[model samples]
Target: MVFSWRKRKPRNGDKKVHNMELEIPRHFICPIALDLMKDPVTLSSGITYDRESIEKWLEDGNFTCPVTNQVLRSFDQIPNHSLRKMIQDWCVENRSHGIERIPTPRIPVSSAEVSEILFSITDSRRRLDRCGCLDSVHKIKKWGLESERNRRCVVANGAAGVIAAAFDAFAGDSFEKNAHAHLLEEMLCVMYWMFPLAQEAQIYLGSQASLRCMVWFLKSKDISVKQNSITVLKELLCCDQQYGEHLAAIDGVNRILFKFIKNPISPSITKASLMVIFHTVSSSNEKTKAEFVEMGLVSLLLESIIESEKSYCERALGVIDKLLETKQGREFATDNALSMPVLVKKILRISELATEYSVSAIWKLSKYEERVLMEALQVGAFQKLLLLIQVGCSDETKEKATELLKLLNPYRPGLECIDSLDFKDIKRSF
Candidate 1:
């Protein structure tokens, strides 16, 4: 593909300079990518492709070579350092043609490297060197933060066990110090990156001491630390059912969660708090749900339903509906000043899920308390229920709406009650 052109006379450095405009050779390109290889490597089939392309091919569950179509026995790729050097040299020679030199790829971290880090943390903890242990934990956290490959390497080599053990051991009086709080943050944050924990790690982290460490952080004055604590708790519990029940068994977990939800540090914290409650509030009997009902969860839920957007509101309403399954919840709702008003206000006004929960809560109230049937009439529930049917909703919701209308039909006001409805405190959650 060379173009015929004139050759000028040799300059003073002609012997030192053999540079000329050259076309790219076919072999210099990756066969799979059909482009120049930035990180060329040789596959088991003796064919070459860019490292990223081959990794993607193997990750997609393909076992055969893309070019040779041969079954692959090993997926390891040896770096084609020789060919990479040739391409780099060619780019340097053709610098005047806008070719940039590609930098060498980094060496991937391995499980062996992470095992050494785990040893340092274990040794530091054994020697009672809190400062040294903190430093080792910081190193592991930094590496995990660098890349997903580094995180996998760290977690695969048992970083979770050592870090969680150290964190649990710090539950003594020293846990009160501000300095130790920072150490706790570093330790817990690393646990977050290693999701889908190994069975052994899950068992160790599910211990009472480990659970206490995170619950303490949930009460930290720092908003970020509070958020991190809740986030880690959610992930740790969500990983296994036994872990969730253990945390729920803690005496003050719900109280702290409800308070956090009431005066949330941020919307994410509020949402996470709701999720923790959602995951933990049930215990196969009515007493557990009753405890939450008596603990002001119902009031907080009504507030969330009014202040939050679609998803959070729907979640809040769902928790409320769950709470109503108990006699205590129904009595509390009928007693609370804002329960019926707030629940009725959300009907036909928010998301379909939210509307469903709201209608269902009111229906439950009407079914047991009997007084809610009139409370519904006062808040313009009858008109909203009728309009809901007209606009259409889930068949279940429509049936409930129909029955609710039937309950209030004799008392249906002669005039529209839209003006009397109050949505005065609706706040933006997103």
Candidate 2:
């Protein structure tokens, strides 16, 4: 039963034998690929498949047999060398039938190779060995995606330090100017795959040079690089509170982050940038509020709330409320043309946190910028406030809304004090 896999037309003058068809044996076909087994390997479930197919399946977080639908005892893929040889022999014997012999696959990277690359990366004298180190790092990153074992090998061999060095070398005079930008983007790609790294790795990657490189990537023409950089920053900066000011002082950091709020490539990217901003403003003071105002963060956040998801709007509103704690933040929100309308719209519209922050922002504006009170009322905010009172809210939101309503129209004849309202029977009309 010789297996056949290809075809050629019979000669015109040949006898009926010339048109005879060659048939393929069913056993030679891989169950997963439905084709002749090239590099055949058997799983614990005793089913054979092409090695690449089964390895990919296991690495994708699957723990069961694709064929038997049973829980796999182990993920080990033992090479079916005898079956592969038989398939190869069949191809050889059927050469006249147009079957092509399959070539052997390359062996995947081993822990030894990864360790060698790790040593090459950290050796101070090897700074001039940039291309080779980068190629090695790139290969490890490729192999890391192939299996859980390879990922562990790559990380155990100090992948974090190598990536950090790669970025640092990019900033220094290691690569030529033309190729420098190219490698910087590549380094970021590697970082993207290695997210949520070990705490020690995060500290090593938080070097001043690495920090600057990541901030620079926020403006990258490649959206992927920008997103990866922001994610990396969030992972590193959020882990340690002491690095907050260091991130804040990076040139163009605030401006670039604010820009992402208005021109985000995706919700995830915007969320990442917002998280970085939140970390940067953790312990911020009046000077920090003024800096954000100068960078137009207030307007960007106000605009963000209009179309962002619930979580995004909540974060933006929370940041805005924090900014309002300072005089500069209040003035910026009051003066921006769309800020009042956007903030007022968020009241009783989005999530509870958004409504809380929106009411707080309005309270601050009414308290400090007395001139903007009527504008808040004109945007239907008074109705939302009445709704807040009618339906009820958190004790704090209820108190703040009560204060704001008094400031808006002090002498309303029928208005009830927040303390006297019974929340259980309250109705929300609007």
Question: Per-candidate TM vs. native?
Answer: 0.71, 0.64
Candidate 2: tens digits of C-alpha lDDT, residues 1-430? 3343434455575344443457767888877777788888888999998877887788799899889989999877788888888988888988767778886655556667887777766663256555765676677668866766567657666677666765665555533354566666666777676756666566655667667777877777888878888888877766775566777777777878877877768888988877777767765556766788777788878876788778888888877887888788887888888877788777766777788988988898888865677677666666678878777789999999998887888533343233232233444323
Off by over 4 Å in 1: 1-36, 82-103, 115-136, 153-166, 169-182, 240-255, 284-297, 325-332, 335-338, 341-356, 375-430
Badly placed stretches (over 4 Å) of model 2 are 1-40, 43-76, 81-113, 124-128, 144-158, 165-184, 217-227, 259-272, 308-315, 351-353, 369-430
RMSD of each: 7.9, 8.3
For model 2, what is the error of residue 153's alpha carbon versus the real structure, in angstroms, after optimal superposition?
Answer: 5.9
Write down the lDDT that model 1 would get: 0.76
